[model samples]
Target: MHRTAPRLARILACAAVPVMLVASGCSSDSDGKPKAEKSQKSEKTDKAGSSGGAALATPESEKKPAVAPVKFTKLPEACRSLKPKTIEKLVPSTKAKAGTPGRSTDLLTRGSCSWNGLDDNGVKGSQYRWLDVSFLRFESDAALGTSGKQRAQEAYTKEVAKNRATTGAKNVKAAPSAGVGEEATALSYQLRKTGEDFSYVTIVTRTDNILITLTYNGTGYAGAKPPAVADLLKDAVPAVKETVTSVTAANK
Candidate 1:
């Protein structure tokens, strides 16, 4: 009977081992489940954070607005921007009847023409005159965020400033010129060169996206009287007006 009691007690101990193992396994599973859930939650949070950041990114519609299109696409011919009679009056006895075309790599955006003449009066000094006209066309740039007219205006302002600061220029004067273009400024000055005083006139005009610069200068050689500022302006104003008209005609 004592041997039976010992065997029964061994059987109970073996059964208790299985029960303890089951309890330990269940506890492990419970702890592992919570850890796994936490890991899954962390992964979901990371994914959600990434998705939210992408949603908050800038869109195309909110970018800078594009600039407006230019009014003039091309420039007028510099040599043909004025009438022959006008040219004759401005520069008498011109060396080149057709005017000399200024060198330019791109004629569509930029061009210039110049004329110079010396009218000789046998015993009296000769009258020397030089005329130059240039055209610059600007285009709207979306990347630069600038409109063609705005760019032209900036250039126009700079041109006026430059003319006002001409080297060796004296008695410089600038005034608003009416009946010329969208905006016009007449700059006149005196400069001495080649042992003679010369009168100069620069008519800077802006029409839409185009800028027109006209410069006229004259001097008397061998004791002839130099041209008067009033006379120079009278000729420059009409010549510049004609050039402006040519711009409209060319675009048409």
Candidate 2:
């Protein structure tokens, strides 16, 4: 009977040990959650942290904005047809003057004449002569014309006012004048200087364009026939008109 009791006691002890372990695993803590559940929650938080770390490693190249292409166009006729010799007379040419002839092969008709020049300061100058009369189909857009005129007038007035303030010229005056009867606007002013070298400025606005002409000569030549320098500009006007016409037609 003693040997049987010893064996039975050993088996009962083994069963109790397994039961205690199972109860401990299933029991709730002070927070009323099982230990196994807490371990699973910790594992889920670690996974989320790992995912956040991976996201932070993204490269900067993916966050950049796309760039747009550059747009360039030909110069307007009023600005383009300026003669080099006339310009040289107006603004004395320096040793560093640079000039190159160019053409607009893009024109529908091939009678276009063009040139490019540079000043001592490396500033570029250009001229274009278009003889094709068919190039006038591209009249200035109505909206663009109005806006351009307004902006040009404002700038001219401001520039004149600033010049007067800086130079303190006596009897400084400016008013709008008719510009060749082309629905154009002009601002003219007479400037007084010592030794009778009178200076006059004419700012002409035509079809969304502006031309600034400055004349300086002694009284002997002021009222006489227009200075030979002035004729250079007059001669270029037809060429400019033709070139502008060609360019406009090509664009259309």
**Mind giving the per-residue lDDT tens digits that candidate 2 earns over 137-185?**
1222343333333543454455445545535244444454444312322
Q: 1-252 in candidate 1: lDDT tens per residue?
A: 999999999999999999998876765555556556678888999999999999998887567678899988877889999899999999999999689999999988899999999999877989999999999999998777899999999999999999999999999999999999999999999999988899999999999999999999999988899999989999999999999999889888
Q: TM-score, each model?
A: 0.84, 0.30
What candidate 2 gets wrong by more than 4 Å, as runs, is: 1-72, 76-170, 175-185, 204-252
Residue-level error in angstroms, candidate 1, position 211: 1.2
Candidate 2 — worst ten consecutive residues by lDDT sum? 128-137
Which prediction has the highest TM-score against the true structure? Answer: 1
Off by over 4 Å in 1: 1-33, 41-45, 59-62
RMSD after CA superposition, every candidate = 4.1, 13.1
